[model samples]
Target chain A: MELSNIEKLLEKYFEGETTISEEEKLKVYFTGEDVSPDLEKYKPLFEYFSQESTVAPTRNITLKKNRKSWYYSIGIAASIALAVGLFFTKTAPEPNHDLGTYDDPEIALEETKKILNMVSQYMNEGKEGLVYLKEFENTKNKFIK
Target chain B: MKEGAFITLTNTFKDKLFRLAKRLLVSNEEAEDATQEILLKLWRNKSKMGEYKNVEAFAMTMTKNYCYDKLKAKETGNLKIVHSNYQDDKPSLQRQLEAKDSLDWVGKIMNSLPEQQRAIIQLRDIEQYTNPEIADMLGLNETTVRVALSRGRKKIREELLKKHNYGVV
Candidate 1:
């Protein structure tokens, strides 16, 4: 391409009017060593643009690594909380052994006495069976005599 | 979109996304983080990726917005010159040093450009995006993009000319 043509393209480029092909022609001309001395000043600018493009960020960026995936963590956390809640709800309802007892001291004492008397009466009945066994043994002894 | 298609879409424009991030943030690490962030967003929205006509442009716009938010959050510090690729091995050490110096100057000048202009220049010149695409990415009209590009180029040219006595024998 003629130098004048490149000059025209550069003008359009500054105004942001150059088509992609025209800009390509400009980059090609400026990148070469044969540029007219007057145009040498514009070379670094184009070179900078090209150089800037070639610059890959020094590190590889893997998107998967940086994704926090908090939803999964939140799901696990919520499930654990629910399980613990259900366990506490199921096991925490044991009634106290003191339930159904009278609150008045006198009434409670009377009830205790009644329970004790019932236990003693049952013991006396058990002793009466021993007395019958003793009479039977005596009758046997008299017959022997 | 399917997972396979999502990956393909990302692979297609990942570099452009990274470069745009790098350009805006001026830090490779931040740019890498931004790119990963943008890609992850795209991955999550992979189901809706098909809704857009131009995924590449959409990704670029996302990066632009993300980097801007990061800037607002004060995540990136002062702009740093990252010119690792501008070196030429064939040149003499002295010429290489001179070129490096030139690139450093350009980087500084680029930093000095207004944020919008800087974005416009990078999209138009470095990434070779069309004016309409750049307009969409920056959320500006075509005329505004052109004006910003013009102003940015002129400033760089004027500064370089002042420094080097450009066009002098």
Candidate 2:
């Protein structure tokens, strides 16, 4: 292509109107050893783009392994935690509160008697107070008559 | 797509995905991670592959999205562009050094561009994608893509011109 054509292409290129082929031509011209001083400045820009496009990652990636590693570890940890939870839940002993009770039948009877005696003593004190009330009622009845 | 067909399709575009990721993330390891993740996602959803008219474009879109998300998630402040360190086959050692230096300058200029503009230039110039295709991948109108591309190229060109005239590094 003529230098005139290259110049026109560069103008269009800067305007973002050049077709892909025209851009290709520009790249080829710039990449050539004999680039004119007029357009030589643009060579590095295209060369940079060309070089960048060819960049394949140096490291090889295993899509399956790398993608799954973290999730897989979490999944396994979660399942283990759940399993341990279920196992502990199933095996946990039932709570028992029977430690404070008397084991001997005689001792149990003696404690019940003590509680009943205390209850009767309080009841008798109330009964004694009622006798005074009976006498007061009798006197009032006589007055009314 | 069938499994076999899906594998073939992925193989064809995996390099493109890696390159796009590398361009955006500016790190090979992160780019490789991004590519692997995207490919795995595509493989997992191979059943829905038929829905997309342009799978390559769709994959490229996924790569762009994933790389952006990665950048957002990263906490590091000083992310630098990783040059593929591509050395041209110039004959003279001095010429080779000069070429490397120029390429490095261009890389820095590209790194300084806004993310969207940088992506537009990468897709349009390096990937040789058509404007419409880039628009599709970027979720922008074709005219918007063109304007951004123009702006990006003009900025780099102006800088290069300045350097050429002033002989400044």
DockQ each candidate and list the results. 0.44, 0.52
lDDT of 1 by residue, B1-169 (tens): 6667677768878888898888788988999999889988988887787798898999998999998899877846557688988976453555345545786767767877877888888888888888888998788999998888899988998876754673342
Q: Model 2: what TM-score?
A: 0.74
Q: Share of real interface contacts recovered by each model?
A: 0.72, 0.82
Best by DockQ: 2
Best by TM-score: 2
What are the Cα lDDT values of the candidates?
0.82, 0.85
lDDT per residue as tens, model 2, B101-164: 8888788778778888989999999989999999999999999999999999999998777656
Candidate 2 stretches with Cα past 4 Å from truth are A81-86, A89-92, A101-145, B1-4, B75-100
Q: Clashing residue pairs, candidate 1?
A: none
Q: Tens digit of lDDT per residue, candidate 2, span A115-143?
A: 99999999999799789888999999999
